[model samples]
Target: MHKHLLPLALLTVALAACQPQSQNAAPADSGKPESATAAQPSQADRAFADLSKRWLEGWLQLNPINATQVGDHRFDSEVDDLSAAGRQKALDFNKKLIAELDAIDAKQLSRENQVDALILRNQLQGDIWSTETLQSWAWDPQIYSGLAGGAIYNLMAREFAPIPERLKSATVRMGKIPELFAQMRENLDPARVPKIHAETVAKQNNGLRELIDQFITSNADKLSGDDRKKLDDAVAALRKAVAEQQTWLDKTLVPNAKGDFRIGAANYDQKLKFSLNSALSRTEIRQRAEAEMKRVREEMYGIAQTVLKDKPTAPEMPAQPTPEQQQKAIEAALELAYQEHPKRDQVVDFAKETLAQATAFTREKNLVTVPNDPVKIILMPEFQRGFSVAYCDSPGPLDKGLDTYYAISPIPDDWSDEQVESFLREYNNRMIHLLSIHEAMPGHYLEGAHSAQFPSTLRAVLRSGLFAEGWAVYTEKMMTDAGYLNGDPLFKLVQLKFYLRTISNAILDQGVHVDGWTREQAMELMTKQAFQQEREAAGKWVRAQLSSTQLPTYFVGVQEHFDTRKAVEAKLGDKFNLKAYNDKVLSYGAPPVRFVRQLMLDQPIE
Candidate 1:
């Protein structure tokens, strides 16, 4: 889903940093010198803790925007230095951390510590690969625009402190906007940039101005005279910087952009390892995705025939339909569902209503432990739009009890009436229910609340993207199994469509990045095979090109989660409780599914 739109700096912080917690002081030395008689923590455990602490400190210093996002306030007034020297320093820091991790003896550590060490080591190595080898800074303009938008967005979006104090901190960050843009210019080589990256950044650059105007200018009454004046100046400077960046992107970068959006087979494989945090390779993911895509489409065909049986669009009921017949049946069935969507202005209200119903269904059916933490349904922030249509913005692990936003983007005003209709049909009423289940109840919001309660702050912050997205997808099926919508086959039909979407996501990700699939090929897979609306397919095509290795998370993650639960059910038999199993899996926090599997079964984590 590409849930995050922030730069790698902020993302590194979100994925790596834990809030600083007070540790017990070393015991006073006994009269006798410490000896082997005194039980000591394993050396490996000590090394892991030390390395984690030092690495976090260094990371926060290097990427302050991330620090702020994780509720670390010391660096709130600072933005990362994106100069070439700064990048090199970050690269060196990662190398040093990787070396330290390599020295740790994982075999000597307890199972939990061993897993933590493994996670940290892989994360550090991945960072080094991305920064030094991938060199996205040299080519991706989103790196700069994301930094700019996130700097202000993080500050103003949360009320961790008094508004005035945060606003004052924002002024300091805004003061550095020009310098940040200057570094961006020095770091980005237009000749190496991708046209799509430049084009996207050109649009997102305007978001910086929109953010300031919406958050700061609109709330001028909340600021003191000095704060307001500083904000005004900062906003003007940021606007100028944004305009210059757009000019550079349109004139210099886009024209000369010669780099390929595809990361190629080798890069895609390496990045997939880090992104998926799974044992599956790219080849394996494609195989599984292709098989699943076929299976899900067949299931959708059966349901479509059931729902659309007297309609002329309904295909003959058989195990195998001709490709054309299969496509027609799925589209006709989906069109029926599309007839039930909300009007444009009513979309947000409809989502809120669906969320309430989903929450009740979870409680009534006892599908899983439903957290009492409140989730607010809001319009997607302007700066954060243009990516996914909806996202579950959970609070940082350090900031427990804050609101988790289930933000949905409104229809853009510039869209033609036809495009709007296509989009609404794709996100039809039944689909919105599926989305609410995935984004709110027993999905990201529920899992995230449980993740916040894990004893290890490190695990909480380093939650796996695969596990998060996978669990959301898994919950959709779980809810359907629990007889959501009173056991209507129509609901199951839509659920299968979403499953197809997830499977097709993996296929599209690899197809574009590794197989060199063109836009037409990708669109055909989405619109025809997956039965996506034209607008939805087009957006996904852009998303697949704009990012890599991310789209596969849903398919891979869900499969791992499903396999884990099946294994647990086999072992426990009648002793297995659905609520307990779900609670227990989530209680481990959002680690890789393989790690979660080991923890659940009391096996050594490899």
Candidate 2:
């Protein structure tokens, strides 16, 4: 959860969001000094760099799983301290860092340092607030689940280190899994644990053993003598630990879980501010999302008129339709596209096809500078499947040359045929391409590679999900507009439906946490208003219940990006080059869109 130490930049889950990276591509941080050439750094700037590094190192030590994920191996043998003392240790660490950060005058720093200073401060302050105010440790079981899951997943997912070396790290973390779970049980208050979160982690608990078997047990031969013995002993202890935890989870945590899933308006608002780091408020996000939903639906209906004009069973598509009429027309068109989906087992291969299409189009259209970095379309790791359907897992900003995983969940065996059909219908052929674009290509993969080259690890590590997701969503429109898939009206229609999901996410999130919307209410927004399939809508309902504050990033980030593009286009008139504008926007790394706007417009960093 360095989305608890995975570092903020390592994992970007789109709620609904690859290409394979080039195998021969250079290392992740191979680029030369990103900003050392920028106006000679002031003394304060140098000090700020040193302080940022120290803070990062200390923070990683406390969240060791994240440390490994971020490519810092020093803490590879350690795990996070979730006990009370550990929480206090993290609290104290943030407090001291923030105090030191404030002592540096922003006016004296370079523009780069100034922006990084704000990002670091936002992170430091957010940590303190998270521990002291939000205090999810005492309530949300998902908080601990990340550390448990990441403990093994982060170690084995990549070949960043040698088999023997990484296994050794895994050995230490596995030995400590019991302690991690123990601290988890000790810290969480049963009365405050939400049933949804408890149930989610309960499903996630056994994934630890599965990870051990697949990675550690299978690779145990790499070690020898005492090392082999150590690995075996660690595995045995970890298996027993997981069994005990699973028993406790099912018998105790799930049954006794009594907390409300909704975080309410106040918690939602505070977390929203920190998560997005945008100027938009909860009310503004809703107001904007609601308005955008209407606009997008209307646009979808217009496309539907083209794609569905001669089809039998097509809904009435009037020139100026009412809400009911418009909804019908859009759904009819999407159903047509949904019929053209991949089969159950071909999803990953299909994703690769879409990635190639997207990559070629991005290069062909020159929409943005596509990075040649290596990316792979992989099956979603067992430990990571419960959170979202698909995500882009990149190396830590500090880690170099590792491949980024464009991981998608395979259809579960236990699901009914109807459930599989529902899922494929939602992620149809056209929809999967949209996902590939958003998750990779000129979306997260390209954006992340650009971000890693930005010269500042601080900026790279503390990337804004708002900007990242927003940029990904924005590209869905950009690619379609530039004639992706030969400008198929059906493709455009599905693209609009995807955008509607992004908009609905913002609305659905607040609707759940702020207005206390029920499953029916949430489903109505996703299925009826957003035109999501039953499977997608149902899964998203659980996602909304399981978490909050991150959903709106897509909406808020995209809105800001759209505004930035329009402003810059208006300013440049004939001189605006699409490729140049795109590169420059990404050149600032993945800072909030607001700051990127300021930088692009030559405004103050504030």
Candidate 3:
């Protein structure tokens, strides 16, 4: 499953490696006749360096499965602990890492090294705050026991480790599942889990069960007799426990789920700072979004008026759905879209064509220096289920070759004809071009190419999620501004529709999780504000519940980029080459746009 969406900039799981331990004693100095100034790169500095490296190594070890997924095979022999002790160990480790990173002299390192230090420091800080304050462990299904079990199993299936070692770890981890489930069943306070998040977990647990069954069924023939017997027994136990867990989830967990879904006044404020590394509060974000929404809506309305000037009643297209017709209309719309899907290969080839086109277009316009070798798009695998139409898989910094998987998740075979149509209506042909520009071509792929070449190891490791996603989001609009539509009205309309998605994502993510919004509220907003197809709107509602504030970055990031570009244009005057500006901006790796802006303006990175 290519769950990792933003290269290393997304969240990470690390393969552990052993390093020399730092001595525990603090540095001391003999008394001097006169007070001595602190020495440069002093003993304390050396201690900080040693501790920081060890902490990084430990983080890698804690996430063996994630490491393997990203091509780091060293931790393939271990599965992480989610037990009380495990959680404590994780906490202690993070705290120590934070202290060590803090002790270092940020100014002493190279500029790239300084950025690396900042990224490491920031990730740890964000992790600590989001966890300790938010206590996502209490609510997030993605980190729940069942999901972790599936992650471990998926890693084993990859077969990246030595056979015996892999089997031994798999067997041990498999055996531990019954206990893990027991712990989860006992420890999870149904009352504490948010209702939507709990429901999502139930849905995800169902998916995990299929993975367990598939694991046993797929590997049954390959295992040795005893190994097969152990795995078979393990699978049976797991399936039964998962089934029992599912019943509990439905009966107890779901029904009793009572925590507030909305992050609300306080937490939303904290999350904005954590997820975005920005001081902008939820209120501020909402204000900005509301202003943009009104401005954009009026502009769109003006465009609408131009097209329908003679018709008095044609102020805007009414949804025209009576109570009974609403669902019917939605179903009809989806069915039409699904029927029009390009053959699967054609979809892949479409991505390729867009990449080539984007590359040539950028070069001709001197938009930015394109990488010599870029990422390639591939089809999404069955193991990774139900995400938006497409996403980009970026190269890990440790991995040399720049391979991009432009994963397109086509309609499932079992989807009803109507269901497929509804999906496609939301992603009409022009919208597809906009999506292509964002995910491949001059968006994610381009940003990734530039990011990979950044000189700092730390920056590479801690690339900003906002920058990556934001660049892609910004590109969709930038291309439109640069005359990408070829004068097609429908294309322009779809582009605005897609931009509405970015806007809607920001508001809905905050609304659902932080404002205690209902599905109906989110649905109405998406449909009315964004003019989204209902089915598509429904999926966004679910996605917002599963993920957190992440959806807002696209709108926020794109706006920041646009603001930066405007500032640069003013300063550079005639010297402002778009290509030079872009190349220099991306070359610093994925810093927050403000940080990138500061660097572009030759200001310190406070």
Candidate 4:
């Protein structure tokens, strides 16, 4: 969901430093028989190790862009062949691997090996589902646009090789852009294309020119004459291809687009299982979300009363305010928080200051082990806009020592004054502090660093989105519990507001995709119930339409983490320590929450 592509198979070697000690017993003392020291690997372990190596090699060869992104330069000059043949080849390969993996006897494996087998099998199954069932190549134009932009962006964004060397690879990739678009046009059925997908791809295709101008041409001085000429020719060809794609989108795709964006109930259910990697069903998720929404709202009402106690129009503190009173009280208290937001241009600066403070607080409280890797705050690239306001772009596990980017999007010039105001209020000062906590410090930046230290390259590359998001959400409560802002009820109030946002995201995702809720219904849930501003609500409606299943990960993941913590605390009682628990949970890399629980509790992995 984060869109940072890497070949999961290619990551085994990078994980060598982070691998756990083998659970198998050591050889007996010298007094024991010589056969004890000559123990051979079990059949399952031998099969797993051999299969993992072969599968990774095959996968990397098929996905060269992923290889490049993950710091493997073997395929640096190659672009993905997005033809029908390419798709079929990939599908066949996955099926073969799945069959091979299935043939192994899991009961014969070590507990750790068994867990890895499960993780790898699920990953393969999910890939098969996407290609065979979901088939985004048939409807999603954004797929091609992403590939084109990423081909050039990945080379320019990192310094894995010399400028000349990377530029040469970029030139080779750029030459393939026209063919890539041609493949996309041939593969996509206009009748199946979503209007939103078409429009977004058109905008993104046009933005490629900006990526060239800003990143490529701006660095022309570093190139030799031959390399510069190659780049110039590639840019000209790429622009023409992008323009043609845009024309096809506006004139052909948009007019004839009859696709429904929703995947409907059956597809949604299957996808949810793979996406979550959790035991909970859709019905269970909805029930839990609805109950939590009510409980969180009640908790927020109490905080709202406390924050608005002295305000002239504040409601009296009742055991339970009527729904109307609760809304009014929350709006008034939020106004106090929103009054301190940064000016439009200062948001990035404010984020920088907030990160520093968050780092200090995390260290002072010993919340978790903060990584020493540097993080930078930068503007979001033009090609990657139109999504969330900010994201943490950490380096691939294979690309060690590089800086992690915390890219924030600036307010668009086309936005009206009212829209701008709405945006700022939603990301008010206190909320920005919470965002930094989630994206940096003890959030993605820190957790990502720890995950990279995992010795299983397979696990490192196949990091779970649910676990990553869940950990960030968990940290918000962790920081709040540690008395952030000297235990300010106002800070807690804003934290609850964010908690409400996550709850609403899960509801809104399911409501629109599964139940066919209209935009107006979604706006009501976000603005009225979650306290999101108008601009924020509108943007989220677009995001929910663009993606499915991902929105629920935050809620489901955090619940698992919370449950895991509670179980550990109950077991340890007075012996429990926060830092130790945090370190141990993160040490497993970003596996499914269930796997993390098994490893933490020494239970047999299912």
For candidate 3, the lDDT comes to: 0.62
Per-residue C-alpha lDDT of model 4 across residues 76-180, encoded as one tens digit per residue? 777787788998888889899999999999998766667778878877887788888888788877777777787788778867667787778888888887887
**Reference-based lDDT, each prediction:** 0.79, 0.81, 0.62, 0.79
lDDT of 2 by residue, 280-380 (tens): 98988889999998888877777888888787888888898988898788777787898999999899999999999899999989888877778898888
359, model 3: CA deviation in Å?
A: 5.0
TM-score of 4: 0.94
Q: TM-score of each candidate?
A: 0.94, 0.95, 0.79, 0.94
Best by TM-score: 2
Better of 1 and 3 by TM-score: 1
Clash count for each candidate, listed in order shown: 0, 8, 17, 6
Candidate 1 lDDT tens digits, 1-606: 425534353233243212223221211111111222255667776777777777767766787776666656677789988787888898889888898788888898767777777777777878788887788777877777777787887777766777888888888898897888888788888777778887777777778878888777777668867778887887787778788878887888778888789989888888888777798888788888888888888888888888987866565665678887888777777777888989988989999999999999999988788878878998887766777889887766554366778999889999999999999999989999999999888798888887666656566656788888899999999999999989888889889998899999999998999999999999999988888899999999998988887888899999999999999999999999999889989877688899999988988888
By TM-score rank, best first, the candidates go: 2, 1, 4, 3
Would you give me the overall lDDT of model 2?
Answer: 0.81
- Error of model 4, residue 146, in angstroms: 1.1
Question: Candidate 1's C-alpha lDDT?
Answer: 0.79
- TM-score quality measure for candidate 1: 0.94
Evaluated at residue 223, the lDDT of candidate 1 is 81
Root-mean-square deviation of candidate 1: 4.2
> What is the TM-score (0 to 1) of candidate 2?
0.95
Q: In the order shown, what is each candidate's alpha-carbon RMSD?
A: 4.2, 3.6, 7.7, 5.2
Best by lDDT: 2
